[model samples]
Target: MSNASFWKGVLPAITTPFHADGSVDHAFLAKHAVQLVDAGSTAIVPLGSLGEAATLSFDEKVAIVATLVKAVGDRVPVVPGIAALSTEEAVKLAQAVKAAGAGGLMVLPVYVYTSDWHEAAAHARAVLGATDLPCILYNNPVAYRTDILPAQIAQLAGEFANLQAVKESSGEIRRFAAIKELLGDRLVLLVGMDDAIVEGLAMGAEGWIAGLVNAYPVESVQLFELARDGGYAASAELYNWFLPLLRLDTVPKFVQLIKLVQAKVGLGSETVRAPRLVVEGAERADALAIIDHAIATKKA
Candidate 1:
């Protein structure tokens, strides 16, 4: 896909809805993909952080991608996450994901083991080199610990034409300006952090790979359009209300929290895989309060 064709607007990283038995509910997963597009998402991203990519096996990831491809089927593009613990693993998975009919890849850094700029760049190169599909380097220093800095991102973008975008999740909005100054349209910037969406768009980010969109895709798409269309006054009004829920995306239990909201809105279940539990207690109460308040005070 061309840069202009695939790399703009709200691309919600959708969750992999699982059955009560913890296996992926492929039927519901496909249904959710269509709903996100219907709800105004420009594209669908499966196996992303919100989808709990780390918890899925290689075959499971491919199956999820195939299911999404069949569901969305020319309606919108499906970009699956390329997350792994090593360069070779990521490249291998990228190859499989491409074969599964994904339109693009969101390449994340080597998980767990912190990598320096060169290692991070090499990891990106390996995956981009292995795939024919366009790739977006996920620069999430806060969660991944490996900061793919502006210099590194510029280097990769310059080296690989396919490395056309970066999901900037550094949480510092100034980094967006710095990146734009350096790359200056060479790389499409997608705000990876949900809380930074409005400022990121205001600063010239072309898209958002949002987690909150998994639950509130309609509002997420509306916010991105409002900001992109220069309706700042209205966007700010909506964003202020969204801020409380958007903040949940930055929390450690964001997967659980987002899934909880998804169930609350009648989209999907809150059934996460092992090692992570569903959002409950004060966290669940807090999230529900925000969702309820947003509904009660929704603007016409």
Candidate 2:
């Protein structure tokens, strides 16, 4: 595939399904991948933060990507996340996922390390060099506490031909304009946050690296298309209705909240790994209420 516009559009950062005992549910994972494609997802991104990549074992990550690739049958791209704390680990991850049949990777910065832009650039170089597959550099300063600045990204783009896009989740929509001004057509910009899509797209974001798409794939797909196709009025209408549920993607308990919504929609189980429990009490009630309200008031 060509580098241009191939990585553009709605790519859902899919959740990793776990069994009651917290084991990786490979069977259901394949089924879920197929379901996402059928629901109109442009591509599938497994093993992302939404998928709890930090908690998964190496073997499990490979299996998940392999299962997703087999299930999707190349109907859409399957890009898994590569989040590592060291250059060696990240390179290993990129190589392993490429071997597992992933079309590309959503590469995040070194987690928990708080590296500066130069260190981030070096990390990207090592990881991008390890695999020939296309990559989307994830820049979520809010979550990772390290900014992958526009200048650094432009430098990486100049050095690595396979660095095709950026998941711009800085929560400042104006960063889109800054990156666009600097990189121009060098990198396709994808909005990373769920709540920021409406304005982000308005600010020249080419697509969405969405989190809530796991539970509401149809709406997510439609939202991206409407916005990209110049249907801003319609997209904004849908986005406003989706705002309440989209806000759930930004919270500390987002994994639990999204899993609960997915279960409510009959997509998957609400089981999370140890140290991260399923949503309960007022949090669960609030999530349920938002979901129910959105469902009841949904419009085309």
Candidate models: Cα lDDT each = 0.86, 0.85
Clashing pairs in 2: none
Model 2, 244: alpha-carbon shift in Å?
A: 0.5
Candidate 2 C-alpha lDDT tens digits along 95-184: 888888889888898878998877878887888888889899999888889888888888889898999999998888888999999989
Instruction: Give candidates' CA RMSD values in order.
Output: 1.3, 1.4
For every model shown, what is its TM-score relative to the native structure?
0.96, 0.96
Error of 1 at 140 (Å): 0.4
Question: What TM-score does structure 1 among the candidates reach?
Answer: 0.96
- Compared with the true structure, model 2 gives a TM-score of 0.96
